[model samples]
Target: MQTLSTDVAIIGAGTAGLAAYRAAREHTDKVLLIEGGPHGTTCARVGCMPSKLLIAAAEHAHHASHNGVFGVDYAAPKIDGKKVMQRVQKERDRFVGFVLKSVDSFPAQHKISGYATFVNQQQLQVEQADGTQLTINAHRIVIATGSSPFVPEFLKSAGDRLLINDDLFELTDLPQSVAVFGPGVIGLELGQALSRLGVKVVMFGASGSLGPLQDEKIRDYAHAQFNQEFYLDSAAKVEHISHQGNSVQVRYQHRDKGLISESFDYLLAATGRRANLTQLRIENADLTLDDLGVPVHDRYTGQCGQSPIFIAGDVSNAIPLLHEAADEGKIAGDNAGRSLKNAADVRAGLRRTPIGVVFTEPQIATVGLSLPQLKQRGEHCYAIGEVSFEDQGRSRVMHKNIGLLRVYGEQGTGLLLGAEMFGPAAEHIAHQLAWVIQMRMTVPQILDLPFYHPVIEEGVRTALRDLNHQLHIGPEMVEKCLDCGPGA
Candidate 1:
């Protein structure tokens, strides 16, 4: 057995872990970064980058097939499944290589290749691949082990025919058919992409949820828009899942067709993800735990019940986005490193305004506080402003007119609070809204910003104008206003 000591020890060399290491190094050189698996971020390896690459290919195919509305005629797009997967895999490995390069640049002495288990609040036991054990006594510890996909117990019956988002990228060619068991971000994105790429896809959700939209109206609008291209049931009653030869069979109650059985090349379990905390033997960590057995920690300071131990990233379960994980990791690492010099060095870190985007056709985005979050806080003094892309000039010009955008503002102050959108250029609009929300701008202030004529952003101006009216600060919206030009 070998024993070592460090000022700070961070688990999992992922996005959060790498960020933590960099942050901790700023405060102390006596920091150790530990990894049990390969070095690469979830975004680079399986989550964001690869998925977007696949989505890009899907968009190209979809646009080619749907451009007839503009009198632009093209033969049906030929989807080379093998070439699509080849590009996805090739680009995915390139992204992973960049991450590996970054990890390689770090000092060798600071990196440990082993799986770590908690011995106590301040101690860890790591088992290396070479059959050696090392005991590490860290002055402060940061847990950033990230998360793994969660498969429902019943889905396991599909045996080897089952797949997850991670497994999907490994395929040599796109499957002929897929039955997606969740309509969350991963399911919707992958399911729709597959459908666009000439694969048969059916997506099912346990609850009446579509993407990340909180507004029921927007969810319904998005549900309809997606169904126009592929089969989706936001709330499904599935009967059984079984392995049939090389394929997976799904039996479910269809909304209009009654009970139905469908066979697919794979049963994708996109249910959800759970924090990777169980294997650490947290029971022996001597820390307060939540109902789900995760450490009770303050998200602001990343401190676990005033202990020297900190939690960050997906393991923290605050927000699973990559940017949030990076922020939390920096906070945890900074606090952990500074605590070595003085325990009082712990302080709340910068928390950015919440912004999320789902890269689906039309797209789905949420900025700042969602409507459900406001209601959860027992706040009622707010007004909603809405715009439909179905008639927006730019959207209509592009023949991409489908979906809705809703902006929220404080009733009295007229301050922009948040927005939920399922519309064209939602990803771009969400970034603009996020900036204003972070700056604490009002509806009128946002309207004062220049909106180019006949652009998709004119739709945003329309929503804000409506919000201003609802706040009693601007004139009532005029339908097809001649003064605001065609789209406005």
Candidate 2:
């Protein structure tokens, strides 16, 4: 077996692993990056980029079909499914190529193209693709193996007819009809996109909630918007799934609706994701694992137990967004390089104000804290400010006014807390609110900032102004102004 030694060993070559590898390089050149799966970051390969491409195509087709209101009377848009998929793949490959090119700057020897197994806390036995073996010993280790889509046992018999995000993007042709078995982010986005592209899609969720969103107003608005586009049956309990030739049949019972059985060309198992930790051999590391088998590491430090090993990315399961993964990776890499005792001093805290965006017709975005989070922490004294997109002038002009925006702040101090919205350009508004919350700005302080007129942002200003009026500290206090130049 070939033996290798490094200052830090990073597992997986996805986003978090790459970030950790880069950060570890700042401290020492002795770093080994081992990847078991395909190259290119998850966002570029299958998660974000290709999915957005699909959504963009669907949006164009939808707009073209419904342009009668704009005085531009055009025939229904013709969708060449194969061509659309080809374009998505072509562009997706370009993005993956760019990510691969970035990795080319690092020395080839520093990266291992293989699956790594933990022989001990500080040692890994890597098995290369071509029956080669390498033993790597590292002073510190970062587990950024990322995650994989979870499929239930009931769908196992469907085999090739079952699709996940990994295979969905590579489809050469669109299915005539699809049944998506999760109304979460992936399920809702892909389900709506398929419906817009002229495919019959039925989305089923475990609960009435569309996704991870906890707010009632935003969820109701989003659910209503989506129900108008495609069939949605949340509160469904899947009984069984059977494959017959090219199609699959799904049997489920809805809480409101009675027993229902549906057949479709494809079955998409968008039932969330689980961390890739089976090969890590955590027993060797002597870490306390939770019920889900994930290590009980500190969310802030990413340190696993009292050992020199750290965990990051989707594997940590603290927050699974791409940006959060990168940040955690940097923190893990930085802390891994330090002495075990001193690592806690430099440990980074997870961002309290979480931000996540769901790219639908009127995008859904949640920023800062959620109502459930605040209640779980026993801090529920908050007020809300809201505005409907139907009232926004720009939205009305664009013929895309279909959702609502709500902002939350502390009741007494008027400190900005969180926000959830389903509206046009909600992603941008969410980011602005996230920044405001990160800066710990109050409602009046945010209102003090300038707001441009005649834009969708003006809608945000209206919400802030509404919230400012509710606060006790705004528009009611004035300080003395000295007039030195005036003759008094």
Candidate with top TM-score is 1
Q: What tens digits encode model 2's per-residue C-alpha lDDT throughout 1-488?
A: 89999889999888889888888888888889999878998899989899999999998888775567878876788999999999999999999999899888889878889999888889999999988999999988999999999998877778789999999998998889999989998998888898999999988887677776788878877887788888787766788889989999888885457787888999999998999999878778777899999988877777888778889999887778899998889888878876433645556656557899999888889998897876675555776777788857678777877788888888777899898888899889889999999999998888778765457877776677666665555552221212211110
- Kindly report which residue stretches of model 2 are placed more than 4 angstroms away from their true locations once superposed: 253-258, 340-345, 349-352, 377-380, 469-488
Can you write out model 1's per-residue Cα lDDT over 1-488, one digit (the tens) per residue? 89999999999989899899999999999999999988889999999999999999998888775655778777788999999999999999999999999999999999999999999988999998787999999999999999999998999999999999999999999999999988999998899999999999999998898878899889988898888888899889999999999999999998889999999999999998999998899988899998888899998999999888999999987789999999999999989987888898899999998999999988999999889876775666888899999989989988888879999999878899999999889989999999999999999988889988889999998899999998899999988988778865
Where is model 1 more than 4 Å wrong at Cα?
A: 377-379
Candidate 1 residue 150 C-alpha distance from true site, Å: 0.3
